[model samples]
Structures are given as C-alpha cells and as structure tokens.
Target: MSQHFVLIHGAWHGGWCWDGVIRELENAGHTAVAPTLPGNNPDDDLASVTFADYLDAIAAVLEQQQEPVILVGHSSAGFLLQAVAPRAAKKIAHLVFHNAFILPNGASQLDMFLPEVAQILIDAAMTVATPHGSIASPHKNVPILEDLIRNALMKDDSTEVQNALLSRLVPQPFVLFNTKVNTNDFLALNIPRTVLFCKDDRSLPPGTFLKMAQSLGTYELIECPGGHETLFIAPKIIADALTKITINPTFHAIG
Candidate 1:
C-alpha cells in the first residue's frame, strides 16, 4: 500500500533536509512532501519566524493531503509536530520522531534537555553575533555545540550536500525553544507513534528520547546507527524503519 508522508525538518534545517529520504520514499511508491519551515534560508527573514509560523506550514501541507498521512519530525521539530498533531490528528495516521524531542503538555524543548545543556545553549546565544553587528540566536549554529555537526554536517558531507544545508541553516527564533505545548489533548488522541534513535547522535542524546517515550506511554522505539543528522548519514535505515511502521501498524515497540 502506498502511504503519504509529510517530513518536517528540525531547527537550523529546512525542507531540503529530506531530499535523500524523499527519493527513497518515492522509489518505494510512496508520496512525500517536505515543506520549508518559516525563517529558514536567505529568502526568509529569521527575525520574524515563530512556532506558530512553523505550525501553519505543517498544517498547510496536511490540508493538501487526500489521505491520512504519516507525519515525521526530526530534532527540534518533534515539539512543533506535537503542538500541531492534535489539531490534524484526524488527518494524520501516525507520528514518527527521528532522534527528536517529544515533550509532554506544558513542556518545552528546553525541558527535555538537561539543565546544564539548556544553560549552555542560553549562555552561547548570549555571545552569538551576526554579520550586521546584532546578536543572533545561538540555535543558528546548533552544530557548533557538538563536534559531530562540525565534523559531519559541514565538513564530512559532500560539497553539494554541505552547500545546500548551509544555505538553509538560519538563526532559529528563541521563543520556539521556550514555548510550552498543550499536548495533553494530543496525547489523548492516541495516534500510533514511533521513535528512531540514532545511536551516534551528538545533538539530543538518545536517553532524552527514551525518557520521552516513557512519558508518552505508547511508542515504537527503533535504534539506528548514525548521528543526529541521520537523514543525511543513514537515509536507508530511516527509510526501512518508515516502511516497517507503515506496513505493521501494530508494531508499537522497538529499540
């Protein structure tokens, strides 16, 4: 059976992040759509982007789908999807998290990270400056905190891939990380959910995701071998996991 998928990219990443996965999904006879989040890329003004803006982008994509689609979110996007999923639950068949955060009601992305991790981010943002002599949000260079992104996202990747990603990376709005989500209603919807944890992810550790799954109560946890940027590092593993979820609706627990 052919399934429709809506792939949501994480912070500092745009829709182009899913290019590799889209090709694999399409080859398997599935329909896929990757929408660029607001405030990502040179054409978009990062200063004006907000969490609601990202929700609108996902909602718009959901509106265009004729069938209930599988909505997949990576990295920071998990929170955004959690906020939008309830409203679009009727149109969404499943929720997939790829090395992403899955916060409960009234929780923010910062809540998922350790207190020290949050502090590091806050402190870093205080020192980040843009070319115009203005302070840019630290989230713009998420890869800087971890050695992996510095090694993988910008350097290890092919020249074409690195350029494409670099063009889309933007200073994420600070409010998005602090915004509280009212996910109580969303959790109650009981949509089938899955989490694919990349073992080598240096961004948000796998332990955080495991805690999220426990709090969520119902989810399939699948472990893959790669970094936080597995969409680029291990697209085949991700595609295979998606295929498993699509075909076996009842397989709710993995990893």
Candidate 2:
C-alpha cells in the first residue's frame, strides 16, 4: 500500500535537509513532503518569528493533505509534533520523533538541556540580541558553531560533508527554544506515536534521547544508526527505518 509522509525539519535546517530521505521514500513507492518551517529561510526575519508561527505553518501543511499522513519530526521538531497534534489529530496517522525533543507540558526546550549546555545556547542567543531600552532580546537568532556541529551532529561524516552542511544552516530562532508548551490535549489523543532514535546521536547526553522518548507513555521504539543529523547524513537508513516502523502498530508502554 502507498503512504504519504509529512516530514518536519529541526532547528537551523530547512526542508532541503530531507532531500535524501524523500528520494528513498519515493523510490519505495511512498510519497512524502518536507516543509521548511517559517523563519528558517535565509531572508526571513528571525526576530519577528514566534513559536506560534512554527505551529501554524505545520498545521497548515497537515490540513492540506488529502489523506492522513505519517507525520515525522526531526531534532527540535519533536515538540512541534506535540503542539500541532491537538489541532491536527485527524490529519496525522502517526507521530514519528526522529531523534527529536519531547518536552513536558509547560516546559521549554531549554529546560530539557543540561544547565551548562543550555547556558551555552542561551549565551549564544544573547550575543546576537538587539537592545530594547534596559533589556535585550534575542533578535539575530542562535548560531550553531561549526565545531559543535562537527562534534555533535555530524561527527562520523567527512570534513567536506560537515562543511557543506554548515554552509546551508541558518540561525535558529531563539524563541523556539524558550517557548513553553502544553500538551494536555495531545496527551489525551489516542494517535499512535513512534520514536525513531539514531543510536550514534551525541547532541545530547548519552541516553537523554531515549529518556525523552520514554515520556510518550506508550510508543513504538525504532532504533537506527547515525547521529543527530542522520536525516541528512544517512537518509536512506532513516527512510528504511521509518518505512518499517509504520508498517505495524506494536508499542511498548511505560509508566
């Protein structure tokens, strides 16, 4: 049977990042669409973008599908799945978190990171802030350092590949990280959820990604090999894993 997938990209990346994955999915007789969220474009105004913009953009995409799609989010987009689920439940057949963040209700993405790591991101955001009288607000967005990307996201890839990846990245809107969300309505929905974890992911502390996946209460666990940027580094592998997991509905329950 043929299936439609709506792939959402993580922070600092545009929908182009999923080109490889989309190709593999299409080759398998499956259809997919990867939409670059608002503010991710090179010319977009980062400061004006809010958390709601991301939700609205994603919701719009889901609403347009003729049939319910296998909604998949990568990296920070995991929370986007939670936030959009309540409003677009009927449009989503399953929730796939590809090494994505799953935040608790009312908690910001920053809260999920270790203090030191979180501070580094916060400080990076502050560095590009625009002065607002006595206070400063993050306006230029958070820039991902090359070393950090090479070490955490594409550690296993070649320098040329890493450099190519870095050249395409845009600053991520800081507001996306600091915004708190409530997933009460989402939690109540009976939609199927899956955590497609890349085992080699080193962006967060070891075991952190799985811990976040555990918070889904009941979810299908699909582990593959790659780091945080597996979607870009090993698209075929990620696509294969996605195809396999969505073929069945077996899930593991947690407390």
Candidate 3:
C-alpha cells in the first residue's frame, strides 16, 4: 500500500521547496524524496551548470532507490522529466506532471510558451562574456523572478506566506530552458502517466494545464484546489490528490 515518490522540483527551487508535500506524504505512511539539482544551491556556480547537470542529479537520486518510484515533476521539471525519463524509465512506476510542462522530442522548454513569453524569458537572461571569450550560461534576474512568484505563483497566498516562499526562491540557470530535449526510450516505455491540475493556478492561464497534458497524447486527469504554489500552500489537498492517483489505477482519461 506504500509507494515511493521521487518529487522533482522545478527551476529556481531546491528540494527544500517540497518540504510541505514531503511531510504530508510521510504522515500518510508513504515515502517521498525531493532531490537537489546540481548548481541549484545558492553556493553553487549557476553559470557553470548545464542542462545535463540537472539530468545527472535526478538520475543519481533515481538510481539510489531500490524499487520503482512514482516520478513526479513540477512546472518546468516536465521538460526535465522528458530528458531523463528514458535513461531510467525502468525505475519509474508512474509519471506525474503536477501543473507541469510536457515537451516533445528535440524541443526546448521555450518552445512550449508563447513567442512573446518565451522571448521575455529569453531576453531576461543576462549574458556575461568570460575573460577567455567563452560565454557564461544566462542567469535570471532575481527581482524579476521574485515578482513573478508574487504575482502569478503566490497570487492567492497570503503576504506572509508569499514573503516566506519568496525568500526561498533562487535564480535559475537559464540554460535549462535553452536546451533541446529528446527521449525515445521514455516514449517506448510503458508507464501510467497522470497530470494533476490546481484550479486556482495563475502561473499559466486557465486551460494551459490541460493543454500541456493533451500534448502527451493520453494521460489521466486529476484536479484539485489552489494555485501554482498549492504544493506548499495547500499541502494536505495536494497530498490527498497524490494518494488518490497512487491508489486508483483507473482515472478519467484526457487527450
């Protein structure tokens, strides 16, 4: 009745972001592990990090588990999932995209967004040339990212909660969005895929979540309450949804 869950945090966040959900899962007698991606740490050099570094970090954590785990990817981590799933598909029991992006092969995360939105993120990346003429990976502006969190992710959250979570936000390695990902093995692998939606999520407009899930061709649709920050803001509800997915083999199919 117990399930192992490897929760993958999206960009700009570390494993610590999943503390709330982890507690809920633990309390429910299930296991959850949120791994820290390399270079995601404040002390780490983000400029030196690559997309592969992120994949390697997740893969390392996946390898440590003796049994297959319910692989849950949040936000941009859906793209991260597509890139790493193939390499360790056998160890993954299910694919859970929690208000996450689902990109196709040979496509970058930016490809999923509107041209203006993608360009905004692209233009937002600050580039610095090195002494050796090499260019550093683009870095996101901390204030800009913080504002987005306040406006979109935490729109429904209280000011206190917003500030608390905002303090935890870190600038992302922009290269993660720039990298083009592909995974043939993951596509060929047989795994139950589920897409969980938060009705109040404003990070992307309404209908965007289902749209991304639709791109997967076929998946189970599970909906809950709260916004994009629901994982932490409404942990119990989110955890309950996760439990429902874990126990129910048959879900309402979408796409």
Highest TM-score against the true fold, candidate? 2
**Model 1 per-residue lDDT tens digits across residues 5-107:** 8999877777887888888888888879898888766577665767788888889889888888999998888878888987788888888888778787898
- Structural similarity to truth (TM-score) of each candidate: 0.83, 0.93, 0.89
RMSD score of candidate 2 (Å): 3.0
lDDT by residue (178-201, candidate 2, tens digit) is 899887678898888888988888
Pairs that clash in candidate 3: none
Query: Which runs of model 2 end up more than 4 angstroms from their true locations?
Result: 129-140, 247-255
> Which pairs clash inside model 2?
none
TM-score between model 3 and native: 0.89
Residue-level error in angstroms, candidate 1, position 53 = 1.4
Candidates ranked by lDDT:
2, 3, 1
Please give the lDDT score for candidate 3.
0.80
User: Residue 124 in candidate 1 has what lDDT?
Assistant: 57
Q: Which is the leading candidate under lDDT? A: 2
